[model samples]
Every structure is written in structure tokens, then in C-alpha cells.
Target: MPTLKLAIADDHELFRKGFISMLSNVPDFEFVLEAANGQELLDKMPGHQPDIVLMDLQMPVMDGMQATEVLFEQYPTIKVIVVSMYDEDRFIIHMLEKGVHGYLLKDTTPDEVEKAIRRVADEGFYYSDFVSRVMHRKMVNRLPANKHPFFPNATNVGLSNREQEVLQLLCDGLSTSEISDKLFISSRTVEGHRLRILEKTGTKNTAAAVAYAYKNHLI
Candidate 1:
């Protein structure tokens, strides 16, 4: 059982200290760094090499969203888990799209915090039941058929109905496994659909595929 190095970035000193205090009692958790804002976290991250970061979305300098993006761009292997007071679906969806490993509300229990960290570290993502339901609903409520006019060549790209479902889920920021569960398909099958969707849409990655879907009203 190797210790997991942890970093926390939050503007509130009291909340940050509370997390540190809680982590201090856990045998397998190591508190490596704390920063008041995103820029400071980025600045301190290079040499510390934490395994996971507990990020706050609202901070004085740069904020968590920008920091998460920059951190992953620079160090893609680092796992980021957002811990904030916000439980809004939109915010959760946005963080998911930006490739965060997990989302936790500030009021989350200590046990949940531990679970979220371990799950994200081991399984790649940790979305609570609420977050999962929101994601599922977002995908289910998409327009029945393509309603908006698409790009000149995009409509001709011809994505199938199943592939369109996968694309909408991707746009909603569901992980491959989450999408699989939602659609009652295997993750591999979901991935295959994703690849085909990209190919048919002539896009490169999930983000691009999502953009193409929105622009073409394929969702």
C-alpha cells in the first residue's frame, strides 16, 4: 500500500487546513502541497509530483478550471479531482468535459473524499450518483432528430443513429465506461462507436467530434 501524494488548491485558508488536518490522520494519504489559487498551484506543481490534486473551482488567481487545463496539458498523467461548494450539473458537466478525474461537493463526507480519491486513482473517474444521473438525463433529453442546418459537407458525413447517441453522450462529458452503462453497451463497443463517429464526422478526437456534432445539430 503505497502512500498517495495529495495536493489541494483552494482560496479559503480554513477549508484548505481542514482538508490537510483530515488527510493527516489517514495512513495512506500524504499532503504534499496547498495553494490559494490555480496559478500558485501550477507554479508549485512542477517538482512536487503529487498523485492527485483536490481542486477548487473558484479561486482568486486563475481559478481551478484554467489550472486543471494547464496542469493536464503540461502533465497529462496527473489526476485532478474538483472539490467545490458547487453541485450544479452545468459545472460538473464542464469539468467532466475538461477531463477531470472526479467531482466532489464541499460538503462531501470524509469517507467519500477517500473513496473519490482512490476510485479516480484506480479506475480513472469518480462521478457520484447525482452526477451520473445528471449526465444520463442530459444525453436522454437531446433533440429527437437533427434540427439545425449543418455545415455544407457535415450533413453528408452521415453518422448512424447509434453513433449519434454515443456522440451526444460524449458531448455531455460522460466517460467511456459511464456512456457504456447509460446505453447498456460494453465500453469497447462504446469506443468503437466513438471511433466511427469521429471518422464519419471527419473529426480527430472526442472534443472535435462534440464540436462537429453541435455545429451540425447531429445531437
Candidate 2:
């Protein structure tokens, strides 16, 4: 097997060093870049291009989300498998939707990590086809309750008609106060609906929520 070039972008020195040390025993992985943050990773990508990146979610200068967005937009060829401590469905779905190949927790065994890396490198995915099917089928339309897999919990709490109206106006570039005025509701209520939307869609902010709405054909 061809040795796969690898890179890891994490803030903790111990984790990075330890992970590299662990992988040293495995000849399939060759560490080419060890970045302290997302910016460093991107800055070094021009020279040290790895076949796959093990990205961390939380870092100081330029977070993993921002870097992942840039990677998905710019370095479309490089596979990214998020290796973080967060195993929540929200975080997993968040990274997966942003074009990452996989999401693994920080404490996962080295063998599992290597398996995930190899799967991503060879098959262009770490999970089974079920996940891909779920993503494509559910994200393309507003599914009814109990109609999906990755977001089983989220789909159970489908958006209300009022919430859909709020989302449409938000997509139309209306501010919270403006939406409140147009809908004859308080700004607080509109803000509350926005938060709920974000929570349900596993989005970080209004922009992400709007993107999710467009992806799901909600707006």
C-alpha cells in the first residue's frame, strides 16, 4: 500500500505529538504537517500538501469550521477527517455536511483512526452508504418527522409553520427587528425562533441556518 501523507491541525502540543508518535508505528501514515491552528495549517498547505487532514474543531486563530469551509472551497481534493473530542450528532453532522469525510472523537483508538483514514482515502468516505443516502435524501428536502437517519432527533422536531415563515423572511435578508415588525411579533420572539432554527438544523449562526434552509429547500 502507498503510504498516505497526513496532517493534523490541533492546538494542544501533547495531543499532536502523541498522535504522531502513535501513528509512527503504522507505516501507512506519514506525518507531513503538524499545525497548531487552522491558519497555520492553511498557510502551510501551499508547501506541505497532505492527502488527508485530521482536523480539530476548536482552535484559536481560525477555527476548524472556517478552515474546513476554505478547504471545501479551495482544496477540494484533500480529504478531511475531523478528529475532535466532540462526538455530538450536531458536530458530526455539521462537519459531514461541510464536506468532511469523517468525524472521530479525540479519544478514539489509533487503530480506528487509521481505519477511518484509510476508508476516507480509498473510498472517499468513512461511513457506510447509509450515511451518504441519508444526507442526500434528507438535506434536499424538508422531511417529515421520523424520516431521516443522521438527524433523527432533529427531524423529530420539525419546524413549525411560523418558524418556516421566519426562516423565509430571514432568507429574504430581513433583520430580526424588521422581521418582527413585518410579522407583528416582538424581536425577542423572532430571535427565539432563529435560535430554535439553528438548534434544529445544527447550524452555528444565522448565515449557516440560512444556508441549511436553502439546502433543504425551506426558503
User: What TM-score do all the candidates reach, one by one?
Assistant: 0.70, 0.61
Task: Give the alpha carbon lDDT tens digit for every residue of 143-210 in model 2.
Answer: 64346344433235588888889877765656677789999999889989988887887765554565
Cα RMSD (angstroms) for every candidate in the order listed: 5.1, 15.0
TM-score of model 1 vs. true structure: 0.70
Stretch of 10 with least lDDT, candidate 1 = 146-155
* Candidate 1 global lDDT: 0.79
lDDT of 2: 0.75
lDDT of 1 by residue, 50-152 (tens): 9999999999969999998899889887889899999887887777767687788999899989988887776456767666666656555655444423343
Name the regions of candidate 1 deviating beyond 4 angstroms.
145-219
